[model samples]
Target: MAAQRMRDRWKTTLADSPYGVRTIEAIRPVLDQWVDRRHGLLTYRLVQLLSGHGSFGHYLHKVARRETSPSCHECGDADDTAQHTLEVCNRWNAQRHTLVATIGGDFSLPSVVANMLSGEESWEAVVFFCEEVISHKEAAERAREDTVDANPLRCRRRGRRRTQFAARLIP
Candidate 1:
């Protein structure tokens, strides 16, 4: 009966929330082990991690709901979830693809999340991958902004063009 309840709750949670669905699906293999009574203790830890309502889980929830904009730092298009960050953000596709290739293919959100949660991959590796992608995206955006800022006409100076150019170059 308890097992049935867990399963029912899982299904209902998934149906009710995209974030919940993603989290649960990402951790499904570990969750499935709970169905066997022998793994009850490990399962309890999984549940705590899944339903803890702490910052870790809440981050995912926020991302999925678009409450926090996961916009591509490159193109500035909204990409508000793990899946979008991993697979669909066109601005970061080349970097993302390269990173995933290094990690091995079939690198969907669930798989990455699973690896992260399960400790199959080192935390350093995960952190490095995320930081690199975000940094690359941010650098792209900064480059775009710098290009716009550096254009002489866009600076809008009241002085002569040569003076403005010289003044701008001085800084």
Candidate 2:
């Protein structure tokens, strides 16, 4: 019950975000209740993460500002938004292809993920996709950290890797 209320508050908060009102309304109904199911606990967790509410780069960039740009460091193109992570990022092309085969026909990420999770059918595939994304992203972030650690002088020369600013939240 507390989780559901938190999710609800999240929806309300998102409704006021830039261009989020309509999308949040559409996704609101499918928010998971996190009850026990036959499948593993991990799938449900991944589902929650991908539901545009998790700590993905999109969430961090927009809601937290830990990222310098909301644009994906992976593809270095489109904004590092939730839809982009699930649908557009080139780094996840193979995983996205596999998920398309499983989920079929261009379903909205939030709705389909929520349903598949609650039903526990094909939920594993969704989990696999999310896992692959996390693995690849972590690897890339680590590579970046290594480069910065090795060449701190070079990084500092270009005025790169500045400390991130915190985003403001309403009381």
Candidate 3:
């Protein structure tokens, strides 16, 4: 059919492109349909988990260079990536267990996508895990930021900047 041809063409084009390689690889195996009526709008946390561009230490410390170390703040793992958080991190074992219970033991990206497409309960389970885990990570990150901001050296640096700006204004 014409629609099938178009989808094939689109997939070919996307496969050839250099951009979005990570996203492409993640969904390439299981992306049969473009859209589904069962799923609702994606949340921030869900996007972060799916896209690998959020509070995870691998993204924050390595990809974004925001954090000092690429270690799991919760469990001290070498890398706190989306995969680790979803499939391996002990910090979220309970939540992961719940997801596994709903979607079965295979938590690979393709399995997850297939399971999500299968039913609402499976989709909600993934969403809940993403929300709870990412929310906790974000809150911990904010608390760390607050602690860092309270450092006397940081306050002195801010005062120094203000003093330099005032000096420039006087001239």
The lDDT leader among the candidates is 3
Task: State the weakest 10-residue window (summed lDDT) of model 2.
Answer: 153-162
Compared with the true structure, all predictions reach lDDT values of 0.48, 0.61, 0.78
Question: For residues 15-119, could you state the per-residue lDDT of candidate 3 as single tens digits?
Answer: 898875766776666656425345645789988888888888888877767677788988999999888898888989888988888999987776787777777
**TM-scores, each model vs. reference:** 0.39, 0.58, 0.79
**Pairs of colliding residues, candidate 1:** none
**Which model is ahead, 2 or 3, in terms of TM-score?**
3
lDDT by residue (1-171, candidate 2, tens digit) is: 897697778767776777644355545555444343456456543653445654356665677554555667878764776677777777788888888777764646556545555555567777777777776665665565468444342132332333232233333
lDDT for each residue of candidate 1 in 82-132, tens digit (9 for 90 to 100) = 445556667557666665644555566466544554443432344555556
Sorted on TM-score, best first, the list reads 3, 2, 1
Q: How much is 2 displaced in model 3, in angstroms?
A: 5.8
Q: Estimate the Cα RMSD of every predicted model relative to the unseen true structure.
A: 13.2, 9.2, 7.0
Candidate 3 Cα errors over 4 Å, as ranges: 1-5, 149-171
Which residue runs does candidate 2 get wrong by more than 4 Å?
A: 1-37, 43-48, 51-56, 149-171
Residue 14 miss distance in model 2 (angstroms) = 11
Angstrom error of the Cα, residue 97, model 2: value is: 1.3
